[model samples]
Target: MEKGIESIFKPYLEPKEVYKGGKNIPASTKKIYKLSSNENPLGQSPKATEALIKAAQNIALYPDQTDIRLREALVLDFDHKLAADQFITGNSGSEIIDMILRAFINEGDEVIFSNPCFLPYSVFSRWYGAKQIDVRLKDFDYSLDVEGILNAITERTKIIFLTGPNNPTGTYIPKAVLEDFLARIPKNILVVYDEVYRQFADAEDYVTALPYVMQGYNIVGLNSFSKTYGLAGQRIGYCYTTAKIANYIRQIHKPFLLPITSIEAAIGALNDKEFIANTVKTVQDGKIFLADAFASLGIKYWPTQANFFIIDPPLPEMEFTDFLMAQGVMVRPVSQFGAPGKVRISIGDQEANEALVQALVKIKTR
Candidate 1:
């Protein structure tokens, strides 16, 4: 115990609350319906699972650190029209976020994002000793206030992080609105657009920043195989930008690139068109069903463009969550996201969705 050593780490000492997901109740023998974390209800892509199994036999060998095969598959199969060099892979979307901050942000620089958007944005910004400017969500709908974000920018602002189909709320910025916002922003400031839930969106007006990236805008598009391909456990995600920016991120990647099995699984997941299609369909259908159930129960819920939605139950968020847990269902209480008294429920399979609806109904009667 060196007494002086504590002083060195004092600047990094700050209270941080761990992000909570759906709680798992082990004591219950009943079939549990985990609608907590927004995971693929249909499970991982069959092709991805098979690929991982095959790749396991060769785990002793090192994977291509550059992730050439996975990047190529993304371009060819996803019709991105970008060269493989324009993409960079990460252990997870969270890692890419961290790398972006590490590579571009400096101490005392300002980072702007919505207050309730993503927990990691604040967590990482603080870790880097950057100033965080959080713009509050507009009204009860929890929509992003584009004007607030635009006005919050200062000369020292290094990055602006926007999550499409935003976490916790499942709300998104319209394509036209985002285009207008970007046009007004100075090109010197980098914009990080996290489109992790883009595949689940069915709105005609929804769009990706890939087109903006193609036009030489100072933007980076972050995506993950976690949701669409059910590869959360695999921890694979990627980012797309100009080749130059991609190169900077890759440099920081160094010895931290994704493992061999994750690369193979991502490649297989990208190639499996059927699995992707079915996953989208399931999420869309489940959303509709859940919306109907909410209406029937007279519960207030926000319209979601992603795989989950926030609802204000008759009970407090934590109490409601506990009730669901006791009934063998799990959901997320988002007080940490700055919207207290609301819970976010991920769309599960039909049976799981029904279980949640039935639980709510029983709670109402009691």
Candidate 2:
């Protein structure tokens, strides 16, 4: 123990034995299609790979600190008020989140968010000595309860994080409802709109957090190249905030955190409009396939606008997930997402989805 470091360390979340599903599957079960995390099953963008290889040629040099190309690419594609001054790149969406909580929250300040969201929001909040406030979703649809969230705020509230086409449940908040909530909330509080899965949305009512940025709600919109562009391995994600705040964050950001190759590849992925359009189509088809299978199995599922949906398990989720692993399929058990009886399954490719459905049926019949 370092002297001053020991007193500053605050722990609120215990590290669970995270099931990085099926790391040790038997050889017979080795053919398993991992649909555990909401990853792009179709794999990385072809263009991203090409760019990455070209970038690998420059490995001898230190990565560029500014990461110019990707920042300009993001600027041209998005219509928000953000300039290059307003963006701060990180290794991933989680890294941007960790930066925000540490930079903005002081000890004892309250952080509010919907329950069962990405676990890191609460975990990171507590790590900063801030209070964690969870407002329960109304039902399995995982629709946000605006009144519930608004009531949770007080003078102590420092941040409110809301995910659109949210994780685990694949549900979204409607524009009118979101507008109403945003309008009513106290102006001082910062609302972080995490839009990692926004690209997978099939609904006509979907709202990107960009407009909120334009309106200057003291909001920060977190976007990722991970899901749609299949740049997960490159770990590129960032936030759009007011220019002043972004400059403030840069003071604490690790120098050269964004690798030059990731910037080039991410830039390349953005211009691969055809590949992105195709990825969206594939993900939509997958959502339909999973929905149909759930209906046929007599299992209930939330109506999803994202490429995944949450299912109410007939058996306990952890046990059911273990059973699926034995049959050479993998899924996320939502026990860790604070819904012990339900599990989330990412919509994979056609053959993989079919295999999952078959394995699920066999498990139920037994």
The clash numbers for all candidates, in the given order, read: 0, 0
- Top-TM-score candidate index: 1
Overall lDDT per candidate, in order of appearance: 0.87, 0.81
TM-score of 2: 0.92
| Lowest lDDT 10-residue stretch of candidate 1 | 16-25
Query: Estimated TM-score per prediction?
Result: 0.96, 0.92
Cα deviation at 123, candidate 2, in Å, is 0.4
Best by lDDT: 1
lDDT per residue for candidate 2 within 197-232, as digits (tens), equals: 888886787897778777777788888888888987
Show the colliding residue pairs in model 2.
none
Off by over 4 Å in 2: 1-29, 79-82
| Per-residue lDDT of candidate 1, residues 188-218 (tens digit) | 8999999999999888889887898898888
For candidate 1, the clash count comes to 0
